[model samples]
Target: MHKYVKAERERQAQRYRARPHYEQRVNFSVGDYVLRSRVDEKLHANKLRVMWVGPYRVVGSADYYFTVEHLINGRTMDVHPSRLKMYADDSLNVTEELIDHIASQGTLLAVEAIVEYRMNSDMRAYEVKVKWLGLETVEDSWEPLKTMSEDVPQLLLQYATTTSDDVFRRAVTTAIDSKQSQRSTRR
Candidate 1:
């Protein structure tokens, strides 16, 4: 009778596993970047809210659970696999046209401040706040340094010069006119 009971328990467990979506867990690992799904149990109004809110780093993991560290606040959390999704770096897309445009342009953007930079993290980039040649204060934003360095090395070189000496000087009208000539030649 005990043997029969053990066999029956195994059969039940097998049946449970056979069900669709059963025992299926989100696959994630420590050090992976993930966005936590926003789940509000309070009300159904959560549907109108933002779906995901992170590029949080997965710090640790168990069988079907993970620990994530917030990129912004450096907060940590142990979360179920269902709460997380892989963070694809969908931020920057440097087009050939954009690269040519950047390469041709001689306008120099000023680094007003290094507002908040997270050092040598996952992406290996610094988020810098910049004030461009002819932009408003409200237009300043956090941009990845690596993207700038790769796409517009000349701009980086120019920025490097201004940054080291701590002088924010404009490149005068000749540079602007030359840029205009370059733009006109492209057309």
Candidate 2:
């Protein structure tokens, strides 16, 4: 039994040595933009959050990893090649104006859909519950119908039409019509 086990181990070692080894190569060059992988705790406990951020500029390289600098923050870190993916950009240059613009921008939440509507405590206006992109149902927010009408007029119109409430429907229609009129006058 000892002899058989020894022979089997030798055969397994030989088979392992017979297979070819492949090494991961860094495909991106220095000065190229790459996104770094990260976990965010606030956004659905990172379950539905955007795991990769930045268009970090690759500033230096080592034998096994690359150094990256955040364009907006100017912070630097070393990251493995496997932890990064190329960020496609039409222009190769990372201008100071571009970085400043991006840095100056405030956090904007993207709306996935207008899920439901409700009346404000005053009972004079409607508020639509907004489902945000990359967020859970529990995080849906209630926004004023007048505020959302300008941003998502078509969605509000659709939601209002489907509901049986006549007052809410008329209010949505009025809000949308006013927004359209404002745009036309500006044009």
Candidate 3:
């Protein structure tokens, strides 16, 4: 009888422990934006709790902790991964001014092509000429390929298919070769 009681107690404990209690984990990367949860711990706090605060920009990470910058005040803070959610501002419609603001502030630029490339002074990076979406030849600018690729892959794909630009293809080919060689060497 005592053994039966013990077994039943263990089963009950296991059932209780298996009940969901923790929030799901959310992953973040550098340059991603997120809002931090603001849960209150006081009595009946659920009724008064605010969900999130600040659309903070993720700047860096160390293990589970993230360093985020406040988009408005420019303040930097360290926050746990569990307390953060990806930020999406659908509150306003996409306008030209908003696009310009976000483009100027964030690392996102919708453009294509490495029309020309030159080795950086440090010999570690390449500056590639970028042709932005809906822009003319006169406004094209040189940007790092790393940033351009991350921002606009569709544009890159489109630009790479343009058979008319011989110089661009050769530059892109050389860069690809060097990158592949480096990766092989690293292994």
Candidate 4:
């Protein structure tokens, strides 16, 4: 009787463990931005120390592993889905003034520009260029450039001190708007 009871308990435990949790898995694709949780204690010792750090682009992926571009460090890192959060898909729109600010304030230096272009026959191609401090590159294409949020002058300022989200939004809006205007003017 004791052996039979022990076998019954084992069967019940196996059945319970075999049940699926039914949690939906988030899908990430190439070029999609994501935020990765920073596990380093020293960098995130307090609750206020930015819980998430990314806006990292998904560069590659396998069945369960994803390779993301860490813009802050200019490196690609592999991570699991559980460690990543979907970044907000904010439209890239800003004014000319913001572009000027980015250019003059050296914010563009730390970003990589993605250029897209079509030939007279409608054939399209893309190119990537890395921008660094005190350097500039002129690219002719349609692909949009992505700059790290932490590298943005206004965002850096906010991170360094106290500021408002409105300021950050305004700066982003300005920068994106200017780039769009330039593209339109070129065509």
If scored against the real structure, what TM-score would every candidate get? 0.34, 0.45, 0.36, 0.36
Q: Which digits, one per residue and each the tens of the lDDT, describe model 2 over residues 41-146?
A: 6565645555677778888889889999877646688998878989854356777776665444332457888889888888678899999765568868899999
Residue range 1-187, candidate 4, lDDT tens digits? 9999999999998887777754656777787777777555545567544356656678899888899875434567799888888874434343566445434421222334322212233432211223443344542223222233223434333332332446444544555566568779999
Compute the lDDT of residue 133 as modeled in candidate 1. 36
On lDDT, the leading prediction is 2
Error of 4 at 35 (Å): 1.3
Q: Which digits, one per residue and each the tens of the lDDT, describe model 3 over residues 65-161?
A: 9998765435578998877888753343435674455435433234645576566777666567877554567868988755555555445545656
- Per-candidate Cα RMSD to the true structure, in Å, reads 19.3, 15.6, 13.8, 19.1
Q: Count the backbone clashes (under 3 Å) in each candidate.
A: 0, 0, 0, 9
Per-candidate Cα lDDT values, in order, are 0.58, 0.80, 0.65, 0.53
Worst 10 residues of 4 by lDDT: 112-121
The true-versus-predicted C-alpha distance at residue 183 of model 3, in Å, is 64
TM-score winner: 2
CA error at residue 60 for candidate 3, angstroms: 1.2
**Per-residue lDDT for 78 in model 2?**
98
Off by over 4 Å in 3: 1-23, 39-48, 89-187
Model 4 regions lying over 4 Å from their true place: 1-26, 43-50, 71-73, 89-187
TM-score of 2: 0.45
